[model samples]
Target: MKKINLYITLKQGVLDPQGKAVQESLHTLGYTAVKQARVGKYMELIVEDDANVEQQIEEMCTKLLANPVIEDYTYIVEEGIVQ
Candidate 1:
């Protein structure tokens, strides 16, 4: 098996309201040192190993996992053993 870890984040110059809100909230909670924060998505998938796993995951990310217009995605594939 293969474990696919995907991370999706907004591209630079895109406004991240959720991250801003979290930062502000942290400041209110006395974490004034918090300067900047950006929120992103992480997803994990377990799939049967294949010769084209990388290509398949890339296509999945582009087609559904991330928005190409404002977000970018990267992934890592690791070998996983299933007993």
Candidate 2:
């Protein structure tokens, strides 16, 4: 089995209103040191180890897991991480 960790985030130049809101709230709470804040999605997936697994994962990200035009996604596949 393989353990997959997926991270999804907004593409550069895209508006991140949620992140901006967090930053503004932090600043209000006197967290002046924070220059920016980003909110992202993290997903953990367990899949059978097979030759087509990598391709399947790529398709999953591009087709459904993330928005290809506005959001970018990256994933890490680890061996022996799932039981």
Candidate 3:
């Protein structure tokens, strides 16, 4: 078995309105000192078989996991021993 971890984040110069909104709300709630904020997604996948999983996962990310125009993604794959 293998474990794949993916991290998706906004590219530089891209505005994260949602993150900004949350930061403002936090300040209003007395959570000041927040210099900046950004939102992103983290995902983990378990590939139980070795059937071109890496290639397929890369393709999936390019197609839908991330937006090439405003976001970037990176992944890590590790071998695991399933019980």
Best candidate per TM-score, number?
1
lDDT of 3: 0.88
The candidates, ranked best first by lDDT, are 1, 2, 3
Pitting candidate 1 against candidate 3, the one with the higher lDDT is 1
Worst 10 residues of 2 by lDDT: 74-83
User: Roughly what TM-score does model 3 have, to 2 decimal places?
Assistant: 0.83
lDDT tens string, model 2, 1-83? 89999999999999999999999999999999999998989999998888888899899998899999999998899988648
Query: Candidate 3: lDDT of 27?
Result: 95
Segments of candidate 2 deviating more than 4 angstroms: none
lDDT of 1 at 9: 97
The C-alpha RMSD of each candidate to the native structure, in angstroms, is 1.0, 1.0, 1.9
lDDT of 3 by residue, 36-75 (tens): 8899999988878687988988898999999889999999
Q: Model 1 reaches what TM-score against the true structure?
A: 0.95
Residue-pair clashes per candidate, as listed? 0, 0, 0
Query: Model 3: which residue pairs collide?
Result: none
Model 3 backbone overlap count: 0
**Distance (Å) between predicted and true CA of 53, model 3?**
3.9
lDDT of 2: 0.92
